[model samples]
Target: METRFLKWAEILDFLILIGSSVTLVAWIFGVPLFYHADGPVLSIFTSISLLVIVSLRLATRHFQLWPFTANLAFLMIVGGGNISSILMLLSAPAVHINPKSTLVMTSISTSIGLIFFSFYEILLYLRRTPNRFWILDDILIHLALVPGGLSLIGHIFQNPNYLSMSIDPRVGISLLEMAFMALLALSTVLSNPNLFLWKFLKSGTANQLIFVGLFVNQYIAPIIYLVLMHDDWKSGDFGPELFIFFGGVIATLGFLLFQAKLEENNSLIRSGIN
Candidate 1:
């Protein structure tokens, strides 16, 4: 019965992802969409829902893996960021806050979450397999977190404007994060090109599609941020934010996909027994 529920949950997640993608595309294409002042509140609710779904899936599937705990920790950190965003939104006046400041805060919370998750993942990965690639990935993830963490701390301290007047500190930090992501992509490609390609090809079709979807969703925002960094930072461009919104939507979908995958895999195992 649990397995059956997870399977249905996964399908629900896919539908959610599809819906989010459509909404984001519409917004990006200038569909004249307006969000409520409680946008972040809605986002937090979504994040919590995703977290619950993911937790259920993981508990049902890979509860025995040592790294599962680390993964759960990472999820919690991501959820915390979502919660923080909700708090910020609620605290601000009903009117729209300055986009630049909002962007900075959002980036800061995301960086903090990513850094914590990366460190935890690295530690868990190393415990399981002490490999050069893992070490490299760990270093890259840590390095990426540094700039954003520093910038966030600076903001908290109310640092006066610095020499780089035009460039928002968040943009610089985001660039570093993107560089790290590029390294991660390289590492994944180099470690097992066939497996990577196979995963991509299988993503939409395979039971493991949830993992693939999650992987893709996680990277999209950073990739978009990287592209936009080359442009003017102060222009209040909506491109990166749109990408981020989509990322959130994708994450929610991923939770559902994971739940479904667990049920499908379990069913196959049981069928083989028969």
Candidate 2:
């Protein structure tokens, strides 16, 4: 599952670029579908940032084609991050359909995360040993996920507080921004087998169990629950907390069953070895 997914990173990057580009076009032409009627507008700068970030990834993937590709990509990543930081500190708003719109804190943080990843990619291009950087890679990717994950949960629960890192409610992240950032970080991490995350997904029973549990709990089970319970949820049969509780129950039960099977297999292997 991991290998197959990672192999498509370049393709995924293109898809993301296309999606972000659509959002840009929508913003330029005042398309209602791209922005919330009652919420913050997706900043044009944000869309442009998405394009640049993904383009940098694609460029790094083929750095050998151009001798300056890595250097240029690294400079752009660092430059973008620095510019975002300056804007963040100044409390300046990014260019958007709404003139009052401010940059979401997650956008700034995501730039920083990418800067680190770009640096790592540079080292890889230089043919450095990857084993020494696994821990750093894991830390950086998880840190990158924090804001994006929070924004996603915020959207799911209809909570504005999770949508931004600022005290000002006007500053919020769009769903597209969060989605792209999360997918980019995850795909980039998985694309490199030497990363701790990829290594964990491929080996021991315990590691596999954790990966399965997280996948089910965070993704599959919630999606199933949401689809099946949409009518009830829409009619106010239960709250978000209840939805989360039941989804977690389903994930936990599935995880326990898988755990039992894994333990049985391990025991058989031990006996055979003995």
Candidate 3:
């Protein structure tokens, strides 16, 4: 199942690459299709970052396409691209580079996510043995997810508050950028099926229970809670703090349920083995 899932993820990554490439081309050619008349437009930097990371990911899929040094070089290239993007955004206004351009400035979340992802990949490449190093990878992945996930939620809820966490007050994430950043993040995580959640999932014990627990906690429950509170959220009656509090509660409960289910499944597996 893990192998099949990874295969599908690769295919999805390819499609994302093609879409991002098209968007980049449109940006270069001044195509209006991807441009919004009065809304956030996808930045050239975001498009380029998407293409680089997605291509790097697909290129290194099996780790057979490149040697260790080559992979490191590519990772450096990825890091450089993001840093250059940050510099460009910061300096664009000062230099008056296409001051009337419709493209939105790249959000800090997008750049930081890519940087953390690069670090995650580098750690994977350099690890001599699994050990607790994978915990570090897990930490990086989650940290990467934090900003990108906030951008996604901000877009989903049409709230500017969630989008302005970038260093530049003017920078905001577009729907396109947020969506692909999310897909790229997920693709990055899926690239290594031997780590973290993937490892537990590949264990093939309590698949249903695990799936249900995560779905409810991560998706169904929070979504429902947010939906119930969205009107108040918009009216200033509800704030992010409350949202975070409830979300933590839900997550804790879900974790307990998931643990219990996993234990039950283990007992069954043990009995069957006997």
- What CA root-mean-square deviation does each model show from the true structure? 18.1, 8.1, 5.9
TM-scores for all predictions: 0.29, 0.61, 0.70
Question: What is the C-alpha lDDT profile of model 3 across 1-274, one tens digit per residue?
Answer: 6687688779778978998888888877878334654345567767776776667667776557555677778777877777776677666644423435555566656777778877777777787325222255655665665565555555566556665522333455667766776677677666666554555555577964765565345434545667887656562233653466346445644554465456556767888953
**Steric clash pairs (candidate 2):** none
Q: Could you tell me which residue pairs clash in candidate 3?
A: none
Between prediction 2 and prediction 3, which has the larger TM-score?
3
Model 1 scores what on Cα lDDT?
0.40
**Model 2 clash tally?**
0
What is each predicted model's overall lDDT from 0 to 1? 0.40, 0.56, 0.62
Strongest candidate by lDDT: 3
lDDT of 2: 0.56
Residue 141 miss distance in model 3 (angstroms): 2.5
Candidate 2 residue runs with Cα over 4 Å from true position: 1-6, 29-33, 60-64, 69-79, 82-129, 165-170, 214-274
Superposed by TM-score, candidate 3 places the C-alpha of residue 70 at a distance from the truth, in angstroms, of 3.6
lDDT ranking from best to worst?
A: 3, 2, 1
User: Model 3, residue 65: what's the lDDT?
Assistant: 50
- Cα lDDT of model 1 by residue, 13-102, tens digit: 444444434444544454512333222211222323333433433343445654555565655565465466546545752332353443
